[model samples]
Target: MSGNARPSLTMKSRCLLTHRAMYGAEQLGSLPCVLHTIDMLIRDDVIWLFWFDHQGVIQSFGVKFVQHTPMFLLVLMALQRFNTANWGLPNGLPHGAPADEFVKLEELTAEHSTSDSQSSSISVNWSARTCRSLHFVGRCTQIFDALVRRRDAAVAKLSFPDVSRVSEAVIVQRAREVQTAKFDLQRHLPVLHFVADVRPQMSAIREFLNITTDACVARLTIWEKLTPIVHLRGADFRRCWFELIHAHHLLWNHGIRHLDPSAANMMVRYVGGASRCPQ
Candidate 1:
């Protein structure tokens, strides 16, 4: 090609141009321009088309942007995964306390299962009180079982011929089940108490708990010092504490009550941090 006519751009040059186009669109603060650039990048599968040349040498063009995009996308994916993994059915009752204060726990578990699941679904019957009462050993064992079940189910689902064609509702239902199982495994399990237990195969648990507790305590101390600066009232402070550190419904079912506001109570380190009185 004549120099005056301009030489053909190489694959690497084209890839760099694509990246520059995307970067420029990102900087322009225009949604349409950004979308158009993305469309152009995907058009004719241009990036992947040039990924492997005829000589079978893998093209490493746009390596920086290509590598960084996946990592950034992975972070976004992780956040989405965490949000979905932590989801639970909304607690309609006030303060997550059961409507009947003195109801039989076993009967309530049965009733809750019936109320929560339709006839087609498999329901795990568990009372919040029972969950909170489980020993550390039992909690860990249950968590392991739940995780195993989730993994097996996922494997089975993907092994099916029609896995890709599964309905959105079915996938969502599975995710909800996995989330519920995780919640059950961790509910009412005290990290500190579990760590303090001397049992075989608990060295790792102890180490993890020590670090977690120290970090938690340090953060709590900072919050305690800052509380007065914000002038948070007793009820507001209690609510904030519960929201921050305690799972909804679990603590309420365990008979743990917020103490009246006092300097001594403020210093005491409860499972959900310092106690505050209602204003």
Candidate 2:
């Protein structure tokens, strides 16, 4: 809700207002959602939401306020096609998204099932991309691949079983690295994403309809569940510093820049009873 809104808005009013746009992202596969009050961006009043399937599992969503349409869906898949080497904490889309082999490309999952039939892959055919932005198509094949798209591919690689076959020490190190990647993916990355517009409606239009907005594009990102960073203590806290450094280099060299990182945005990821911190 905007601060200058003529009439103060209720939460339900806000939720109802945004629901159609959020639900339009049919590929996210989330169940019905309820808007929550965890304010994310003050400038756009972007907040959080909770989604629950029939079985009652919780899925979290955070809204990223932006003006232009995000091109992550294109840029990330292109990166996977261009890059040959895999980063330690794989850019999350992990093994990679092939531009041509669009079929069975695997939607992201922390479970990292080696079997292909388990998940649905995101696909875009020539005809489907007709309405997309020209810049989006150009960047998808050129430099500056969508940083957020890079996130999904990064997440796909997390939790992957390290297949390194060397000395016992090397094997042990690689396994730890895999654990760290999975922990970081859940703690720091956006696993699922979609864009929506949340602009204002004219008074007359509002009275008759619920489906109009301008170009105030916002990207809603869903992430793995996380624990508060406050849970880290003593040795756990100190160890987190090193892990954060490792995660940073992996992301920076591979092409994702985390602009605003702080304790407020960081989380404590526990894997096998150890606090795995990804800054």
Candidate 3:
């Protein structure tokens, strides 16, 4: 396929094509079976089994595949949403945000972009930049918090392995530790309190805190990686398709079978006229 050519297939057609490219033509009939297996893995919490097996008993290609599949699906969903938006389709972004809120977000992004080109001088308008940065960070935290809550609820329903053979005291302690590690609104209260109490003398400390918080937030929002696809040219998209093909071959070389391979599970990063799989 030529790099500059638009993908001729509709989404459904592209899905099938990508699957065929990943798993080979003979394995197409097994796609449904693969998907069912992945569903069971997610529902049963088998992804965690590998971690608990200290002797590497469950550390196999299949176990690694199961553990990674959830993240793969997340990336795929993000890509599909980006592509939908790129095609001028309804993006299905969260609908409850007021129009004014979106306008504010756009305004912030515009101002941020404008600031990037200005000279790095002490005269720079740091106060406006700081406020914009804080607003963006807060919005990101809210989104991340929502995602974490939903995940925690789903995880609560999942069936973990029976540890009844272990002491009840140990299990209870472990459970408490896990709960404490989980992110909740209460965990961020101190940081929020500090930001709200900003003092002139604490400018350096506040900047440090902002940088730390931004780094943490960025780590939690891998879905943002998909946004680049919205700006990709037709040639870059085609290159991405080829990169997915290469990824399939690479997996095969390592004797790893991506049974549920599909367009949604494959992600391509485009940079400097080249394309590569994020995985």
Best by lDDT: 2
Candidate 2 residue-wise lDDT, 128-230, digit = tens: 1111211100111111112222323211111101122122223223333443435444354322322111112112222343424221111122233356576
Give the Å error, residue 23, model 3. 39
**TM-scores of the models, in the order given:** 0.16, 0.28, 0.21
What's model 2's lDDT at 66?
Answer: 38
Alpha carbon lDDT at 155, candidate 2: 18
Residue 152 displacement in candidate 3 (angstroms): 24
Q: Roughly what TM-score does model 2 have, to 2 decimal places?
A: 0.28
Using TM-score as the measure, the top candidate is: 2
RMSD of each: 21.4, 20.1, 26.0
**How well is each residue in 1-279 modelled by candidate 3, as lDDT tens digits?**
123332234566446544433333122112111000111122232221111110111111222334457665764575567442232111122222223221111101111112222111101111111111111112212111111112211000001112222322232223333322232312111111000100111123225435321111111111212223334468876765565555545545545445655665554444465654443
Model 3 stretches astray by more than 4 angstroms: 1-233, 270-276
Q: What is the lDDT of residue 130 in candidate 2?
A: 14
Off by over 4 Å in 1: 1-15, 24-239, 247-279
